[model samples]
Target chain A: MANSNTQADFRTRLQDWIPKLVLSPSLAAMLVFVYGFIAFTVYLSFTGSKMLPKYDWIGFENYARLWGLSHWWTAITNLGIFAFLYITICTIIGLGLAIFLDQKIRGEGMLRPIYLYPMALSFIVTGTAWKWIMDPGIGIENTMHLWGWESFEFGWIKDRDMAIYTVVIAAVWQTSGFVMAMFLAGLRGIDNEILKAAQIDGASNWNLYRRIVIPLLRPAFLSAFVILSHLAVKSYDLIIALTGGGPGRATELPATFMYSYTFTRNSMGIGAASAVIMLMTIAAIMTPYLYAELKEKA
Target chain B: MSVATQDTAVSTGRVTRTFIYLLLILFALFYLMPLFVMVANSLKPLPEITGGNMMALPQDWTIEPWLQAWSSAQIGVEPTGLKPYFLNSVLMVVPAVAISTVLGALNGYVLTKWRFRGDSILFGLMLFSCFIPFQIVLIPMAMILGKLGLAGSIPGLVLVHVVYGVGFTTLYYRNYYAAFPTELVRAAMIDGAGFFRIFWRIMLPVSGPITVVSVIWQFTNIWNDFLFGASFGGQSQPMTVALNNLVQSSTGVKEYNVHFAGAILAALPTLLVYIVAGRYFVRGLMAGSVKG
Candidate 1:
């Protein structure tokens, strides 16, 4: 009887541990892959690691050099422009389309997917299509010339000054539809009674949106801002495919900068430093939003 | 007075509605222009695209570009076309998706059903991993892959994707399973169902919707990933990298039609998924961005 009782207790204890055992693999992977790798990269940034990772500590030297490089400055400046325009234009176009579609329109199901199919595509595919369309010799400009508008010019893809804007245009085209969907979901979630009450109180359609609707979409807006900003910081494949960070380093963002430095230029320390700065930038934006979101749920 | 106001509002609304429809259609056309251009150009002969008007329909339609892009286009000195790389993508994506999704489902099951101390904090740590710029991990990941003898190979790429992708799949499953009633799990336990048994018999049986969302999300992302493919895919590059090579290769004359055909081929799988399961796709997108 005592032996049987002890066996039953052991089984029960084993059952209790099965869940944790099941979860341990993923936890271990995350610890080593995510946090451990991050720690390794952070450590590499402070060392004199070049061509390959070395152990000699060089303390802030890489970061100071990174900040001093004109290429790095250009990359940062281009990101500021790209992110600003991409965010603003996407918000405007997205909010407008969402509002317009929200009004009891016909053929919404058909139209919503059209706005969104681009998001399903690879950025490389997007870059390829846009690169062809934006080419000065054979694309829109050529087509316009064939249509007897001989003076029409759309060579932004090849232009040094305007190359970054081309990136913005492609990014916007790919992502704005997603932003619209988020807003539409938010718009749908708003209580109809609130809108009805506002209408009865003599709120015009314009005022109704500007006051009640837009304000209520604060969460969606915040989500869009955070998601887009982070995406902007991490923009790599798109720029590589579209511009190749080219026309003489005109369109380089930090992502491409980091890649070139680490792999091509033999400056792993500087590349790691640049990558760390990029992380800090994203964290600065994400930390607060995630905190509030997780805290509220908790 | 109310009737008069209602009449005026309806009349103005009709005009505004017309304007709104016009704008929506125009925007739709704008959004669709690139797809149209790609399809039309891919069907046209090379000379037609370069010499003739781009907006015009093909004077002589041809499937030569598609055949070439599929079978014989030069992607970095190999005239092997996109077939091998497409296969590489398939092999990489399937296992990566399967492993990540299974691990995520188990992780979600534990976090929600088998609640323990400091679970939320652990969950938070995993959640934040999803948002970090992957550049931070690139150098170390490359080193690690090299150390493990998996560098520049499909398995290496798969492992990389799985590591980054698990965070997302976990988020999806955890949020989904949270709303699932724990009472079912509890009852199963009382009935002598083991942890795996309850998960398999009870939890998974009802996990169809979230599974679809998770699978579709993982499929699209892994299929479309370029950074990892470019960084780690040396000899066995995926379709996107192959396509980039085919387009950017400057040795020969720019074959726009071939490039278009290749681009379309790269896009077809995800496009088909979007067309078929777009509702779930949107849900996944929303769920990913807006935290529960």
Candidate 2:
């Protein structure tokens, strides 16, 4: 009876702690590694820490220094440029592809997969391929030269002024497919009768799509736009793989800058401050868009 | 079926059809062109890859690069290859996807069908968690993992993936469950089926489409990931990390062929998943549960 009771007590203890064991293991891992580090970094940002997490509580000094840093300002500016240009160009390309494919043409399925395959591939691959393709000495320009056209100058990638545009091109390739998928979903979900009625009214293809289709695809457009912008804001991998904020921080975005500061430079305070600012900027930028989108859906 | 209607349909639609086909073909070529260059170049020798036009087919076809990429050049060692890292990727991604999807489905079941207090709040928290950048939480998460002595282990990486994955998986499952009729759940409950029983007997069986979505999404992310694998996995890297070390940060003699082969190797799993699950992927998204 005593042994049975002891065994029962052990089982009860195991049962009682199982949830904690299971849930806390993962949660605690994330809370410490992810959330805990974030909090630690934020706290470190407020202190006079450098090289590592040392604390002296030098309130707002890190933020002020970060703001004063020209590279920091440049990174912020570059992020804005990237976010705007990338979002616009990708949206246009994606919408165009989606609309073109929505016509129920032959090979629609094949075309859809072709468009989306890049999204499946890593940004590293995309960046490598683009880098090689955009190389002035070896790629398209050289090909043109071998073909006896020596005047071709596709040197945007090497040029500091045009390097960001190359990144944009790669970005468009990687993301437009996702947007296309969203648009296609919206297109298929629309009522066929509306198109039939429009056709009966003698609407041309351009007019029908422009006036009827595009308007009805507002929900999809909104969703695609928000998602793309979010991605654009978080885009560090592509930038790193392609340029590494190359040609003297000319292509620097906030994420890479924060990474360099936090890890490479060992400037924990500034890094944390930059991270906080990035979070705030993203929140400020996205909250209104999300609200508008959700309101439309509601 | 009428002659006149057929003629009109043919005439009007033919122009549009031709235009659409032309555009699609062009876009398809544009999309395939770079991938084609990568693979075609990989087939060529290093000299040929560098010397010839990127568009050119390999004059001297060789499988040496593929062999090399599979063996020495893949992992840090110059002999063994990427077999271990590939196994690591599989080990982490499988459990990550399985756990996240199962938990997500459970959360969705409870939130959508069950009349529970604080359900909306829980759901909202899950949704909002998606927007929090990993950079914000990466440090703390890493520190915590280190504290727990799990910072450098595969199980630790799997746990991290599950935590991050929960938000996305929940969204996926919630979107799916919301589109489903509530009457089914109500009927099941009125029949005196307990929560776990209903989820197992009814919900799980019906969750085919969304399950595919969750599985594919989680698997792809976990597989293609570089940041999590690089940071959390440490010396024991996933395929992407090893691939990144090989291809991204290269040394003096750039073997373009090997790099291309490595890229192909790295992309194989996600590409295969996308191709296989492409139809259902679109179907799940078009199920129109996640409007935003």
**Model 1's DockQ score:** 0.55
Docking class of 2: acceptable
User: Which parts of model 1 are misplaced by more than 4 Å?
Assistant: B1-12, B283-292
lDDT of 2 by residue, B1-292 (tens): 2333233231246676777688779878888888998899889998886777888889999988888877777355454566677788898898889998888787666657663555554455456556666666655566677888988788988988888888788778877887778898779867766567777888788888888888888888888877678778875678877766776545567777887887788889999999889788767766754663
Q: What C-alpha lDDT does candidate 1 achieve relative to the native structure?
A: 0.90
lDDT of 1 by residue, B1-292 (tens): 3333233231236778999999999989889999999999999999899898777778898999999999999999989989999999999999999999999999999999999999988888898999999999999899999999999898999999899999888888888888788898888888888898888898898777788788888999999999999999988788899999999998979999999999999999989988888886566545433341
Best by DockQ: 1
RMSD of 2: 4.8
Worst 10 residues of 2 chain B by lDDT: B1-10
Query: Positional deviation of B30 in candidate 1, in angstroms?
Result: 1.1
Shift of residue A152 alpha carbon in model 1, Å: 1.4
Please give fnat for model 2. 0.40
In candidate 1 chain A, where is summed lDDT lowest over 10 consecutive residues?
A: A188-197
- Candidate 1 local lDDT, residue A223: 90
**Angstrom error at residue B41, model 2:** 0.8
